[model samples]
Target: MELKQVIEILNGNVLTPSANLGRQVKGGVGADLMSDVLSSTQPEAVLLTGLCNPQVVRTAVMADITAIVLVRGKHPPAETLQLAESEGVPIISTRYGMFEACGRLFQAGLPCLERPVNGE
Candidate 1:
């Protein structure tokens, strides 16, 4: 789905003014643990989390994530927003909780990453 669609679906507010809303996101991953996100998320996925920290932006950069949705109406710190801007990661804020946000995106046709059948 497109980032613009995500913003509309989640009723999100764009915190990064420079972020492009036209970017396409292939999938969605909801996690507060940066390690879990790093291990599981695919490239160009949108990360949904309530963890509003600079590390989230760093993790998004490392994972090649396209966008970030901060659930539960949480907003990142200025430093975190600055880091996200520097990394070209768009940060979005939503009033929905993590579960609700994920559900909304899923209903909107964004799938979660699938684990390999071999458990690799």
Candidate 2:
């Protein structure tokens, strides 16, 4: 799914104007914990989280996340927005909560690919 399609599916608004809305979403991951996001090996995945902050943007950028979906219609602070724009990370806000937004994305064929633990 493309980022544009995700916007329509989740009824979200793009907070970062410079973001590449046409980028393909290879997978999805819902986690408020940045540690969990960092642990995932999936590349170019969209992150769905309820926590709206600069750290979220930073972690997404570091994790190479394709985009961010802020649940419950939450928007981040100006610092977060600025960082996201500069980092070229797209941040989207949706009216649906984290669980529902993630489910909708999954239903739309975006899978959450978590890395195996301890070579399991």
Which candidate should be chosen as best, given lDDT against the real structure?
A: 1
Candidate 2 Cα errors over 4 Å, as ranges: none
**Local distance difference test values of all predictions, in order:** 0.92, 0.89
Report how far residue 83 has shifted in candidate 2, in Å: 0.2
Q: Name model 1 segments beyond 4 Å from true.
A: 114-120
Worst 10 residues of 2 by lDDT: 110-119
Name the 10 consecutive residues with the lowest summed lDDT in model 1.
111-120
Tens digit per residue, CA lDDT, model 1, 1-120:
889999999999999999999999999999898988887787899999999989999999999999999998998889999999988999999999999999999998998863344476
- TM-scores of the models, in the given order? 0.95, 0.94
TM-score of 2: 0.94
**Prediction 2 global C-alpha lDDT:** 0.89
Error of 1 at 78 (Å): 0.4
Which pairs in model 1 have colliding backbones?
A: none
For model 2, residues 1-120, the per-residue Cα lDDT tens digits are 899999999999998888788999888888888998998648899999998889998898889999999999898999999989898999999999988998998898888766777878
